[model samples]
Target: MTRNALPTLTLLSLLAILPCSGCQSSKAEIDRRAQHIAMLADDTLDELDAAVATGDVGDAALSHIASAKSNQHQIKDEADKARTALHGVEDATPWWGRTLGNLAIAGVLIALVILLWQTGIGFVIKRLCYAIGLLIPRSTKASAALDAEAIARRRACPEQRESIAARRASDPAYDAEFVRQKKRKQRDEVSRHALPKEHMEIATS
Candidate 1:
């Protein structure tokens, strides 16, 4: 009687295990599907992040996780549409035709640059560079020579000689050269007046 009860207990245990085996497999399959979905969602989000890093997405798209997810789907959809449109455009345009168009535009731009250079635009550019301090106006040696020449001219000017004469009135020994300049200026003034009178006398005669 004990052996018979043991077999009955074994049979009951088998029945319980057999029912649980199908349920366990179904639960595993559901978990696997959920994990796959989660992995796919993560991949999509990563793609969105890459797009944002490349400046393809704007600030508004990256503000919140929920909105970002929405943006991700929208971006994906738009990209798909763009790809489809691009493919259609490519199909409509011949490869050689596109290449020729690009080459023509590049040639025109090169010709324009050559024309501008030939028209002395380069000189204008050099002048602009000088004005902006990218180029020097004169060499140091040349500038020094020019400054010396200007100083000599300024000192030799008659107006400056008169100014020196005025200084001599305040300081007797200010510039002895002023006395010679004053005498020369007075002689030139007298000669100028005499010339005008001579001219009038000649005209009357």
Candidate 2:
């Protein structure tokens, strides 16, 4: 090789290797962070599971669960922000769409199915015709635990409640519907507690 050629080759090789090495480092960092989040989330959730199983599970337990979920969400947000800073938004997984260009080159049926599911078109269709059956609204019941958790969330996050209150105050249609529902619920409760006809007659007489 010529004397000048040696220096040019070394520079080109370094230029090529540097970006790959940097990418590997970034990938390692991302993996490390994901592991940390997983470990912390697992420990916290296990504790909450035990609480739900054996503990009294009052407002405190519900609060803990809500707090844990909120923390988990925050962890995800931070991870995403860090990744965006490192690799940019385009590198992150697309929220509402998935690419199909790869399918043309190395297409796998399973990968295609998974990608389709990530698309917006697949979402409602999946919900409409999932494994069991058509997933209709109001077809399931909420347990006492779920109800307690919801109440605890409302109590813990006053800001969320304030936002909801603001929305209700702003939207006349929503406010009217909310009032109508509350009145209907109150009427149902009163009807359930009403005395029998004979008992009412005797009491009145």
Candidate 3:
């Protein structure tokens, strides 16, 4: 059987045997046995005493004393055996075995803590570094230079000066190009709608 199955079956067997084992002799039966033994011992003792008290200290009295002594010895022997059996059962237990078992458990827990510290701690630290990096400024010299150039152009251009002085301004180069395009379009329209040479000469005469 598999290791796991073996333990499960063993547990089930123990549980199944519990009820049968628990069905021991009743209290009444135990009490009756105890009373019977006590009565027998008392009778034996009384008979021995009476035989000794009477002047009949003969083979009969001797036999009676021997019988009582044998009974007492048997009872004592049986009690000693029972007590020894109980002690054996108690010593057979695996209670002290848990010391080694608990040490093994503690070793496993320590290994897990070390593993988490080695692997998990680095990952957490890396993530925190990335998050903190995002909040840090990353401005470069090239961008600052471009901004300065745009400001200079806006200051130099006359029409762009006013717009640049407004609450917000476009890049000076862009504003300059826009104004040039507007002037070119206006010149083109004026030339297209101008009077012809003949009309201009008659008007002039």
Per-model C-alpha lDDT, please? 0.53, 0.52, 0.50
The clash numbers for all candidates, in the given order, read 0, 0, 0
Query: Model 2: runs farther than 4 Å from truth?
Result: 1-27, 89-205
Models ranked on lDDT:
1, 2, 3
Q: lDDT per residue, candidate 3, 61-84, as tens digits? A: 688687776886576556445544
Q: Using lDDT as the measure, name the better of candidate 1 and candidate 2.
A: 1
Position 58, candidate 1: lDDT:
66
Writing each residue's lDDT as its tens digit, candidate 1 over 1-205 gives: 2433544544554554444333334334444555555556668898767777797666676677557688666665654454445433422334655555555555555555555566789657755654344444234324333333433445447775565446546533222333333445567667878999999999999
Best by lDDT: 1
- TM match of model 1 to true structure: 0.21
Give the lDDT of residue 186 in candidate 1.
60
Clashing pairs in 1: none
lDDT for 39 in candidate 3 is: 62
Query: What is the Å distance of residue 17 in model 1 from its true position?
Result: 16
Query: Could you tell which candidate, 2 or 3, scores higher by TM-score?
Result: 2
